[model samples]
Target: MRIAVGEDDVLLREGVTRVLLGAGLDVVASTGDATKLLAMTLAFRPDVVVVDVRMPPHHGDDGLRTAIEVRKRLPATGVVLLTQYCEPEFAIDLIGDRPQGVGYLLKERVGDVDDFAAAVKRVAHGGSALDPEVVTRMLRPRTVPSELADLTDRERSVLACMAEGLSNRGIARALLISEAAVEKHVTATFRKLGLAQLTDGHRRVQAVLRYLAAQGP
Candidate 1:
C-alpha cells in the first residue's frame, strides 16, 4: 500500500519508513512538518498516513489535528497517530471521529515490527488499532456509580474492547461472538451506561474516558 509519514524527529521518521519498506509497503512521502504532512497527503494520495503526535511548531496536537483534517478531506485515506507515551485523552480526540480507519500506538511499539505492520495494515483496511497500554490506562479503578456498577461481566468486557477502539466486528472477533451478538451487547452496554445510541467514534471514547476519569487516575 502507498503510505505517508509525518514525524518531526528525523531518526524516528527514517526508522518508521524503513520498517514500512521492509514490510513491502511503499512510502510515498515523509515529512517533518505538519503543514507538509497535509500537503503531501493531498498530493501523494497515500492509502495510509502514519503521524507522530508531537511535531514542529506547536509540538502538541499538530499531528492529531492533521489527522482530523485528513479524515475530512480524504475520507478514503487511513491515519495512524504515533506517540512516545500513552495519552488516552489525545488518543480519544485523534480517533474520536472515523474510528474505523484510525489508530493510535506508542512509538516504542515499533520494536515489535510484526505488530506495527499489522496495525498499519489494519487501519489501511478500515479498522481501528489501539495500544493495549491505552486500554489499560483508560480502565483503571475509579469511583463508578452504583448504576454503572450494575453492568454484567460480559458487558464490562465489551466496554473495555470498545474503549480500546474496537469496532463491533472487532469486538465480536475478540469475544468469539457473532457481529450481530456484538451489536446487541454494545447496545445493552450503552443502555446500562446511560449512553445514547448516537454515541460512536470519539463521543463513545469521551464517554468511556469520563467514566474512567471519574474512577480516578
Candidate 2:
C-alpha cells in the first residue's frame, strides 16, 4: 500500500519509513511539518496516512487535527493517528462523526513490525484499527451498555480483540482457542450487540463502534 508518514521525531520517522519500505509498502512522502503533511496527503492521495498525535506548529493536536481533516476531505484515504499516550478521547474524536477508513493506535505499536503492517493494511482497506489500550481506557469508568450485558464474558473478550483489529486466527491465538470458536463468538457477539444490520466484515467495525458507544463520554 502507498503510505505517507507525518512524525515530528526524526529518528522515529526515519526508522518507521525504513521499516515500512522494508515491508514493501510504498512510502510516498515523509514530513514533520503538520501542514506539509496535510498538503502532501492532499497532493499524493496515498492509500494510507500515518500521523503522530502531536506535531509542529502547536504540537498539541496538530497531527490529530490533520487526520480529522483528511477524513473529512479525503474520506477514501485511510488515516492512522498514532499517539504515545493512551487517550481514548482523541480516538473518539476521530470516530466521532465518521469512523470509516480511520485508525487510532499507540506509537509503541510501531515497535511490532507485524502488527504495524497489519494495521496499515486493515485501515487502507477500509477497516477500523483501534489500539487495545485505547479501547481499555474507553471501557473503564463507564457503565456497561444494556446491549453488552447480553454478551457472555468470552464473547466480550472476543469483541475487545476485534477492536484491536485482530483477525479470527489472531484472536484465536491470543485467546488460545480454535479459530472456529472465535468465529462462533464473533457471530454471537454481533447478534447480541444488535449489529446484525452490518455485513460480515462491517460487523467487526460496527462492533468496535458499539463498544465505543457503550464506553463513551
Candidate 3:
C-alpha cells in the first residue's frame, strides 16, 4: 500500500515513516506541515494517509479538518488519524456517516509495529480500525439502540470485535471461540440489528456504525 504521513513531532513522523517503509508499504510522502500534507495527498493520492490529530497552521484540529476534507474530495483514499490522547469525538467526526476506509488510533499504538501496519493496510483496503480504547470510552456513557438491547452478551462481544475490523477468523481467535460460532453470532447480530439484506461488507460496516452510535453525543 502507498501511504502519506503528517505529524508535527519530528521523531514520531520519522518513526512512522520508517515503520511503514519497514512494513514494505510505499511511503510516497511525509510532512510535518498540515497544509503540505493535504497538498501531497492531492498530488500523490496515496492509498492511505497517517496523520496526527494536531498539526501546523493552527496546531489544533488542523490535521482533523484536513482529514475530513480529504474524505470529502478523495473518498477512496483511506485516512487514519493518530492522537496522543483518547479522543472519541474526533473519531466520530472523522467517521461521520461513512465509516469505510477510516481509522482512529492512539499514538502509542505506533509502537506495536505489526498491529499498526495491519491497521493501515486494513483501512487502505476499505476497512476500518477504530481504537478499542476510544470505542470503550464511546460506549461507557451511552445506551445502545433498542435492537441492540436484545443482543446476547456473546453477540455483543462479537459485534465489538467486528468494530475493530477483525475478520471472522480473527474474531474467533480473539474471543477464543470457534469460527462457526463466530459466524452464527454474526448472523444473529445482523438479524437482530435489521441488517440481514445488506452485502457482507456493508453489513459489517453498518453493524459497526450501530455499535459506535451507542457513544454518540
Which lDDT tens digits does candidate 1 get at residues 1-217?
9999999989989999999999999999999998899999999999999998767655556777788889889999999988886867666666665578988898776678888988999999999899899988778775545645877656666777877878887786565445776778777876666676554665567657755654565
- The Cα error of candidate 1 at residue 171, in Å, is 36
Worst 10 residues of 3 by lDDT: 172-181
- For 99-163, candidate 2 gives per-residue lDDT tens digits of 77888888776678878888888999998899888888888885557869888767887888988
- Clash counts for all predictions: 3, 0, 0
Q: List the candidate numbers ranked by lDDT, top first.
A: 3, 2, 1
RMSDs, each prediction?
12.4, 15.1, 14.9
Best by lDDT: 3
Per-residue error (Å), model 3, residue 153? 28
In model 2, the clashing pairs are none
Give the Cα lDDT of each candidate: 0.80, 0.84, 0.88
* Residue 87 lDDT in candidate 2: 69
